[model samples]
Target: MAHVDSIRKDMVILEKSEFANLRTENEKMKIELDQVKQQLVNETYRIRADSKLAINLERSRVRVTDMFTDQEKQLMETTTEFTRKDTQTKSIISETSNKIDTEIAYLKTLMESNVLETVCNLAASVFTCLQ
Candidate 1:
């Protein structure tokens, strides 16, 4: 009967040790689960921020494209206007040059005619005075 009592006491101590080990394992599992949950939350936040940044970048690209298109159109208009003005200026210069040439030719002919008439009159007066 004394031996049976000793065996029973040993069994109680073994059972208590097993229960403490199980409690420690449960605490470790809880800590691991909390860490996993925090990692999931951080990953989700990063994904959301990346998505927003992508959307903003796309919007900015569209705006820049629109501005570039508008600038291209304005440049084309300005170039066309300058070409038209250049053509108009060239035409006016050509007409003015033609008029100036014509005026110079007329003045040269008039001067030659006047010099010939004066020489002819001087010769006739000299002949009359000698007679």
Candidate 2:
């Protein structure tokens, strides 16, 4: 009976040690799981921030493209208006030059006609006096 009691006591001690070791291992695994959870949360937060930044960048790109398109339209309109004004100015200058040329030609013709009439009258007077 004494021998049986000693064997039973030894078995109990060995079972308790095994239970303690299992508890320790379970605690370590729980700590590791908590660290892994925190890492996952941080990574998720970083991904969300990156997603927001990408959305803002896409919106900015769209806005800039719209602005550039509007500016290009305005530039085209301004260029068309400038072209029209330039054409009108050229027409006015051409008309003015033509009018001046016509007036100069008419005045030269009048001057030549007057000189010929004066010469004819002087020749007639000299012929009559000589006769």
Candidate 3:
């Protein structure tokens, strides 16, 4: 009976030691879980901030693109207007030049006719004098 009591006591002590080890392991696991939770929170915050920044950057890019598109449209319109005006001016100049050329030709024809009439009168006068 005495030997049996000693063996039971030894078993109890071993079980207690194992319980303590399990408790220590549980405490370590708790600490590790807390660290993991903290890391997850930090990562979540960083991801949210990065997402917001990306959204803002995208909005800015869209605004700049819209502005450029508007400017390009305006420039194209201005260029088209300038081309239209330039073509109109060139057409007016060409029409005026043609009218001037026509007037000059008419004046040259009148001068030639007057010169021929003068020569015929001088010949008639000379012929009368000879007679």
lDDT of candidate 2 over 1-131, digit per residue (tens): 35545755665576567556755665675576566556655655565566556556656677677756665565566556556655665675566556656755765575466557545755766686689
Flag clash pairs in model 3. none
> Candidate 1's residue-wise lDDT over 36-118, tens digit each?
55665565566556655655665677767765666556556655655665566557556655665675566457546645754
* Whole-model alpha-carbon lDDT for candidate 3: 0.60
TM-score of each: 0.47, 0.46, 0.45
Which residue runs of candidate 3 sit more than 4 Å off their true CA positions?
A: 1-63, 128-131
- RMSD per candidate (Å) reads 56.3, 56.8, 56.1
Q: CA lDDT of 31 in candidate 3?
A: 72
- How does model 1 fare in lDDT? 0.59
Q: How many backbone collisions does model 3 have?
A: 0
Model 3: per-residue Cα lDDT over 64-85, one tens digit each: 7775666556556655655665
Residue 79 local lDDT, model 2? 55
Give Cα distance to truth, residue 118, candidate 2, Å: 1.6
Please give the TM-score that candidate 3 achieves against the real structure. 0.45
TM-score: model 1 vs. ground truth: 0.47
